[model samples]
Target: MEALNQPLQVELGPLRERMGIGDLLRYERLAGIPLRRRFFVALTGVLLLAIAMLVALVWLDRTGILAQAPVLGIFAVGYAVLAAVGFVWYAIDLTRRARLALFAWVNGWAYADSLEGTRRPGSAFARTLRSRERGVVASDDERLPFELGRNFSIGTRDWGATVQRPFAFVELPLPVKVPHIVLKNRRRSIIPTLGLGRGGARMELEGEFAKHFLLLVPEGYQQDALYIFTPDLMARVIDLGAGAEIELVEDRLYVYLPGGTRFDRPATMEATLRLAEEFQRRFAARTELYRDDQAGDLAARAGVAIGLRGQRLAGSGVSLMAVAATAGVLLLSAGVTAFSLFGGDLLRAWGAG
Candidate 1:
């Protein structure tokens, strides 16, 4: 915790310095094989495009067409320029990722440019498919472990559209498994689409907390949630979490920020670290000794266990408003089609008569 208070060493000056071929290779290795392959693929495409452009220019010059149509030459040059620009942009992004990884290493944190196939216990992790995390910074401290990252979940919506939505999350693993509880940020309108839908019992807290968050827990776990989310804890969560959505599932607490926060920014990283530290400290204390009394026999056993029903929220994957909107759109489309077909025919008949 003392290390977190010290000035964060996030200067970009060293990263901005010109990198040698050896430096590039080192960074590529640090970035991992997946990202390295991506860089090579992009480089190959750029090289091939440049070669093709050169060949075309040579052919045009030999045919004397360059003299006849200067505009054609200009267009070819433009295409090559655009391809070069794209290549440069991709290269810069790769370098930025490498720098971020290095920074994490220097600060004793684990870094991953791509979190494809990596598994973590969370409610959002369970439902989402084709999960991918980028620019993840994980604390190496076993005492205060947490991960701050941006992830996008790929899944088909009810309308059969394949959608990929991005979100920023802070994942903190707890000591004991607790009943699933989701504290949905009411201010951010996007959480419903990305979150575990809406069927679980909506828990409205007393006072101003209700306006800030709509707490959701499994049918019988309302009291359990209340037990964990004491007034002081709720106040701390509201103050630190801001508009971020919170969910306690399995043995982890996930705080998700809407619209995906950037991990590249220094200020953002510091703030995220602070939030994670405080959240882990406060929430973990509340839940560390929590043994779901509803677990009965399991509670009677040596280890802690949540009740079967309390283990997961019985919520629909789609929100009520989303369902209503889809239905409305379908009905409106049907009405329009019916009017266009039958009403047009009736108008024509009347006109003829």
Candidate 2:
């Protein structure tokens, strides 16, 4: 019995290591309904309701009561109710899924950021990977560096403009067989479809945003072809030599590379690790340079600082007011339609003009 139990215990260890609290929550929420399934369910419900309404309209016409004022009024009210219900249901369902996706994306990015503070120097996790080549910086009162990268060009604009200087740089040597690569941020901020040009060849990367740092990898790189350094999770690109095209998908701060051939030997890991280390060192240097440049720019602009906080607050208030006004209009329109159909009959029956 002891011998048999030993093997079972060993098997369970790996399973337990793979399980996490976040995984459980995600499983619970996505248990039965997939994104595509939810969309289909809502679409089918609306189509069925439309068909039923059409059938009812046809029946009313055949009965020669389609033009009867009171009857038409009732039909209009019923139609309005159906429309409202459908709209509400669709909106609720869409909002729920969008919220879920956004939540997951943000949580993942936060996790990566937290890891940044905990990373040990000379450890894999502590070092920046080649893909992240960039970092986001922000101030307490105003200005965010990430927004500048979003536009990918320098110009003066609202929301507090600031220039970024590269503090460090990291470079990865590509395998002759690997045609495309991706870079990802743990925050999933980098767009995947945007290809980075290197040596006149466009290298594609997929981004993945997680809690500590952004991850980048060659798009469509095989699962088995990549590995992280021990105790660090600093990702590496394993060279498979040949066969299959690489693809990238970028989300948040991480990139996913898939559709690559497998690595068969320890030698592959060694070669990849070497490249990963070099890339990491370069990236750290680049970040330092960027921070230094930004600090200087901030000091210069300190004199020009005006009441930006107040402006932001006022803009937010105006936006809220507009949203409230729109909602009020929609509600008023719906209420008027309802009253016109239902109250019209009540007034006529009471002999009111």
Candidate 3:
């Protein structure tokens, strides 16, 4: 029993050590501090402004110089503006830093590489496997191995909120052939596209066909290929009468055709349309409505606007109240000075009469 336990213990020790190392590396790589730092910095700015305002109010009260209403009013407005600017600046800085932090985390080892950069494999089947490996390649229950190459294209359009900028459009193009594709409306705002490569042959488009055609190329494929396309605006691509040839290996998908084939068949067109619809649905369900970076930007902008507006309003209200107080103090001071200089003489004359 003792001998058997010793072997088990030895095996467990190495495994534990490897796990610890991996855990440590992960923490180091993904740990973030930007958000916390920004919060503290913004807080500090507010505190400092508050302190300065308190000191100024106290000094003016004690010196009996609060009688100057006009001068005090100007100072109050200046302070309000200054505080508003500071708050806005802090919010923008915080948002920018937060975005950087998010980018680091998403692109870290925890997430797989972007599909856009994956290379296709030399053999048809191998290309598929490479694509799977490059993306978060998986199905419902099991992790899918790299298989045939696939292409993904994403696009977006923004309807302007204000009148100045009415609309925005963006487009992204993909080079590899994709089978199973996903399309998502990152903002739940626009639709995206996914395209498959024409077989192993490359073709150029001409005339009216050229306007709707997109060039699909096979390059830099190793093992298997997966293509990911993210677009910024509305764009569509037609198959251009080309069909993609793919081979499956080791439960992976690969593109066998060196170049995509041209397909002018009715069947191919129907298949392509079906494939596109499937991808669109898959992506719509899976894609997140808002990305971390975009969320941060929106939050930051809102926070800054709110903070600045609130600060300005508060400061203005306080200054106005102070002005009224100062005005009362000045009137009291003048009355007291006049009484001291003339009251006794006036009382003596009234008594004699």
Candidate 4:
């Protein structure tokens, strides 16, 4: 899908926040019935609230507790201001969706009004921890510019309660096959909950990068992890991230934003995309092309269970002590065979004695 070629700041921004019927005509022409439907829905809600207010005013008048037309006029004016605020908010929300839809189209990306039925199966966004999940959130994901997706409520284990992290993510596919790693800004939160916490080993990198973030990587892959996160890359990550976490799980490198995608102003969106693009560009040569043959049952091979001395030989299926003992027996048997053949002269000497 592609958004129509329009200057977003010069054209789209003003037209949206503008409150003239002329702008509605433009919106109606572009969006047709959808824009109108939203307006009517908001209008209906305000109308009902107005009716309730009117009834209250009539009740007050009949009771003679408060008599004045002037008092009611002032209250009506205040209510109108409140109603305008509500209407403006509703209009802005609707217009933004329309803008985003068009924006996606212009950029040669697909756009969906919501994430439901659009979410790819087995995607990270589709999985959630039940207790932390927030139900059915509004989502608008576009494929163009980047694989940017938002799942309304990404659940987290926050302070022993289920917290909704309405997250927006830009997926960066790395050229190299790197183990899952997470780099979270230490200054942002005391606990790196959204980085999925410290799952394996927490690594502190060298230089200013180390000062800003705590890196977590899988066991035995510390060197490989370091290779991927070079000082330059780390610097770029820090420079680009607007204080969000960078999570690398398998091939998918996710730049996780704190709030819903819609909450991002245009500037934030631009910065995020810019950062993701830069990272992708720097790592393009290193990225390995995906193939089904490359897949392996790595989990089946990792060690499990506690061991006495066995921990030393884990994942090898045999103990180091067993190998040593077996070698010792083999050497002894070979010596005995040599002695049997060579002892003939020794036996005769012993008989003479």
Candidate 5:
């Protein structure tokens, strides 16, 4: 209620000539804190650069008046580039905020520039996997929509360090929990591993799906996985994005795009949202409703906080093949050492014979 009442418009446009007090008062009195912070940072950078240029100009007097043009031109170009970059960033961010607002408004859901009161400590996905910086979620609607985040960084220092990616997903409310399932592209070596990257027991689906993607599911859930991802759904998923990887952990359907993809563009956002929405709709009937949902309903009535859903896939759960390979390596090493030690004696015996 308070968020809605706070201020009505973003008010980016202007066509005023000595605007009246009433017209001026209608717009929000103050810009948001983030805009102010950005302005301050840019201002500080320009000021520091100007001071440095002035000091350099005084100290480097040997250049004479003739060389001043080139030197001044360098400084001017530097400043211009900095200012242009700042302006571009400002324009992009402002447009992004407006689009987010429009998305929330059209869907009749509340929007926040940051996470909205969701603190899921127990969940490994939110607590560990995804970054918590400037995540936006739209909830308070019947649909219980998705959280779209830009520049979410995840990964270890060893595995290419911190990689930023755009993640857009909607949580599928599964009444009966399901096993983890993943569909990855087959062509490229997506993961950096010594040998083959094991992703649990491979669940091969019918038709052309196998040609493009390799589906992996937990041991017990192969049959259920087949049933869950029907032939029609498989075709639709393929159509969604050929390069993207789709994952199912418990209840959530996640479409993970390659790292370094940006969601600021309308086309990108549209495609992401369209695919996610399709998945949600397709899986709706399959998720069997349970009486346990009432606990959530009761909590909602009681105003209890909701934790973030853990989408860590329980992992591929490691591989016995990897351990087997390691053992094989050790045996080969031992055999090589034995040959190295015994070769002299064997060679001498053969010559004597």
Candidate 6:
């Protein structure tokens, strides 16, 4: 709490020197962070040089070096453009990561350039073909162990578009595993892209709370969700997290914000901290003693366990609206085609131009 009161401190002078490609690679290797294709970049540079040399040799060996001048020039120009783009991309990525890493260092928080295969329990963490978390800031404080990062994932066919979707998230660890509960903010279009699909039962809260949030909980676990999301907590969520989507699965609570939430800004980071703290404090007590009676003897053995059904939302990740939209597109196209063919035939039969 004291740290949050203090201004966000970042020392970039020393970090600037280490932003070089070699230094960044060393840092990544030592930190056990994913390389993000650093080695591939180096390999590509060498391969490009080799290809250029080969092209030069072959062209020089031919009798009409002058005749091939245009072709060689084109190759060289393309090669230069490609190399320049790669270099620029590499520099930007490394600089972004280094600054975030420095921010973590000054504040005594853990940082990762890239994180994958987390296998965290949440609708957000469901099966993904390509998934990664970058620029991650994590706190080891047992009082409110949490992680803030930008996550990108490409879901499967049932999961919607294979296009990678990016979102910023703050995840807090819960004391016990609980049923899946999701709060979809009614205000954001990105919330629907979470691919929560039509899973679970849509729960409507009393009063104006229903206007801001659409709650989803496992079919029979409505009581559990209501218990956790009491009136007071719901109010806090509406006030602090009206723009973010909230999901609780197993033993983790994830607050998903828009992808553009910039951790690089002090205000943004502070706001995220406050949001995480509030949610953690409120949720911890409500979930600490929670045990699934449906777990039977397993609850006794594991101390805290959720039943298989409640462990995950039964609905597939595909949303009904997405299905409806796709169907509508197909129907529209079919209708257009039918009208074009039949309308033209009708005109011909009536001898109308």
Best candidate, TM-score: 1
lDDT of 1 by residue, 1-353 (tens): 77855533434343334565566668777676565367677788888988998899999999999999989889988998999898888777666666667667777788887888657766555555567887787875756677877777765444232233567788898888989888877777444433453466888888989889888888878888898999998898888886788889889889988654655556666677778877888888899899787888856585658877888877534444656666799999999999997998889999999
The parts of candidate 1 lying over 4 Å away from their true place are 1-25, 47-89, 156-164, 193-199, 302-304, 319-353
Error of 4 at 114 (Å): 1.7
In model 4, the Cα lDDT at residue 239 comes to 78
Which of the two, 2 or 4, has more TM-score? Answer: 4
Q: Order candidates by TM-score, high to low.
A: 1, 6, 4, 5, 3, 2
lDDT of 4 by residue, 112-204 (tens): 544444342212343334312111112133222346655553323332222334556666665544455567667663212443422356788
Model 5, residue 60: distance off in Å is 2.7
How would you encode candidate 3's per-residue C-alpha lDDT over 109-131 as one tens digit per residue?
A: 12222234344322211112222
Query: Over the full model, what C-alpha lDDT does candidate 3 score relative to the true structure?
Result: 0.32
Worst 10 residues of 1 by lDDT: 155-164
lDDT of 2 at 146: 12
Say which prediction, candidate 2 or candidate 5, comes out ahead on lDDT: 5
Judge candidate 4 against the unseen true structure and give its global Cα lDDT, from 0 to 1.
Answer: 0.53
What lDDT does the true structure give each of the candidates? 0.74, 0.31, 0.32, 0.53, 0.51, 0.74
Q: CA lDDT of 100 in candidate 5?
A: 50
lDDT of 2 at 51: 74
Please report, as a residue range, the 10-residue window in candidate 6 with the lowest summed lDDT: 7-16
Regions more than 4 Å wrong, model 4: 1-37, 64-84, 117-145, 154-160, 175-177, 189-199, 260-269, 286-353
For 1-353, candidate 2 gives per-residue lDDT tens digits of 44422311111121112323355345335433355445455566666776777777777778877867557747755885776587666554344333333332432311111012322111111222221211221112111111100111221233111212122211222211221223333232222222222122222223421233322232232221132221133332222211111121111111121212011112432332343344334333322222112223554377422122111111110122334565799999999999888987988878964
Of the candidates numbered 2 and 3, which has the greater TM-score value? 3
Clashes of each: 0, 68, 53, 10, 0, 0
Mark the regions of model 5 whose C-alpha exceeds 4 Å error after superposition.
1-36, 40-44, 47-51, 54-58, 61-87, 115-130, 133-137, 154-166, 187-199, 258-271, 289-353
